[model samples]
Target: MKITSAVVSVVLLVSAQNSFGQFPAEEVSRFAIKDFTFESGQAFPTAVVAYATRGRLNAAKSNAVLLPSPYAADLHGYDAFIGPGRALDPQRHFLILTGMFANGQSSSPSNTPAPHGGPDFPRVTIRDNVRAAHELVTQQLGITKMTAVVGYSMGAQQAYQWAVSYPDMVESIAVICGNAKQYPFGVIRLEGSIAALKADSAWNNGRYTQPPVKGLRAFAIHYAAWSQSPVSWPRDMLDSMSNQQVDQFLRSLEAPALGMDANNVLSQAETWKRHNIGDSPGYNGDVEAALRAIKARVLLMPCRSDLYFPVADAEYEATFLQNGELAVIESSAGHAAGGGADSQAIRFIDGKLKGMLQ
Candidate 1:
């Protein structure tokens, strides 16, 4: 159950390497929409959505599997489950990996031009991301239907959104460590992280001349405490740390956050805070009704130790689904369990996904 520092380092290293396009991709492309409209009614000219694909579309174009990026991740977010013999074997299924709107790879506060850049960037919703990905699949890839939509964390939120928003388009969806709605407690956690990032003087109300190192560090510290289980801190960190080494360990945790753009972080956090399947058309904010409307088979995999998306929430949500299964990840890795951070958890997930896809 304990994830040692070495394991943490390897995970970070792999993520850093993947960010540079090291992961396998048959092709990497960007789909641009002219005058893209947000769910909030704000419009941005030439919003670009970045995506990557592996494998070839069969004659019917029916073997497509969509993998949406989680918060702060890119197209390669599902690299661990995609390979020759993996659950989502690229050779067997055409894998369409998408970047989240605010992850910098896609249209984001960091990459967008003025007027709609930085603090002025319009709020993005999980439904908005689904709409964009829908366009990419239908218009660009000519995919009429997807065999599955598999996701973890924020990506899982998108997966649930896809099932409800375009039920007929997705045959199945696997939601890992995410819920159909952003519960009040989850909103508070995200708000706290956002507040910490914006509190630094150098943040300058999102017009920072330089990176807000202090603010980012504070945000990272806050996130680190919640991202993993309380038991993990003692097993993986406190037990291994001496008084003299405490500061070094804390700095290591801050490194990743420091490299991220402040505005980009805020943009995704806002999107996460606003996610709700019921927000889709005709639901009237009725979460249970939305879940009942979904036609796709659902696999709900919530980590037992996940503080952000509790297992109890997933179990309750599963009851509403017309066709859903609840499978808890029994690991102390918390949310990371669903992100392929634990080898055993990854195997369990892959097996479940294989069954779902079958």
Candidate 2:
């Protein structure tokens, strides 16, 4: 799907400006912390983390729902399922938004230090990202415990990390569209995406001022294949996207004007690839053993047709979780729907969250 320049510009501008303008009903906020140190023993020369909150923290600060942003997604992704009468209603639970590392927003290469801003930012892993979130919830918000830490895709990986890293801090975890380990095939695909970016002459070894926009678009296209369901690309979605051919849908999702650095994407993808609860510091244990260590009740929400995180992945991971439940969002909407506000996902989230919090 070849997105016309006009539509690209519009989406980019809106996405750039508010990130959550489409969901005005929910309250959100943004913040930046200079030289944010990372768990990978490195620090971004400069970093910013965008966040949004709804409702209010109770006296004991236990009614909090920590939701991290998905890859290439902003906090708006959860709006439909988080309002009043919804699973994550701010009226009852304090919802906190955390931007994933290198999402081209909040502490990303696009907003990092001068000249080297784009891809030159330091590498940060899922573990590193969660630790920073822990700081925000504990030190900044003065919260000692949370009702839940929930997310989809990359955000889900962080949720898992939170459960393992601080089992005592989180009471429940809702993970949608993700798994415990990055399968070798998935790793290869991510590597190919970075390769597509680096192969472009514009990359200049991550030093290009205006890195290859075309290459970035191609990378986006490459990711689209992995992100969406194989057979569910809607005709309307295809029409809205500029790509003339169904094959080009992913390319249309790629926005070069966003100034998202290729190196940054590569680093973050690699960071996610390194995710593993068994690798926890001082935890020389089996994968199942580490997952079993998590005391938080778990909800594994997988899209029925997710191409990237297949249902089998979630099923295997669920078995390891100490107190876990498997909830499938039966939809042909694929992986994109996992990030979307689908009704089935909403119901699943609502039921699981309400039960866990209760």
The top-ranked prediction according to TM-score is 1
Q: What are the per-residue Cα lDDT tens digits for candidate 2 across 235-348?
A: 455564443464453434565324455665676777877777777776663567778788998888888988778898888888877799998888665666566534565576
Q: What TM-score does model 1 achieve against the real structure?
A: 0.94
lDDT of 2 at 80: 52
Provide the TM-score for each candidate, comma-separated.
0.94, 0.83
- Report the lDDT tens digits of candidate 1 across residue range 1-358: 3347534833463345226334454566889988899999998898888899889999999999999988788776787788877789988999998988888878989888898998888899999999999999999999989999999899999999999888889999999999999999999999999999999999999999999999989987877777777755554445656765776767777777777888988899999998899989999999999999998999999999999999999989999988999988988878777877777888999999989988
lDDT of 1 at 26: 52
- After TM-score superposition, what is the CA distance of residue 308 in candidate 2 from its true location, in Å? 1.1
lDDT of 1 at 10: 35
Model 1: how far is 238 from its true place, Å? 3.3
- 60 Cα displacement, candidate 2 (Å): 2.0
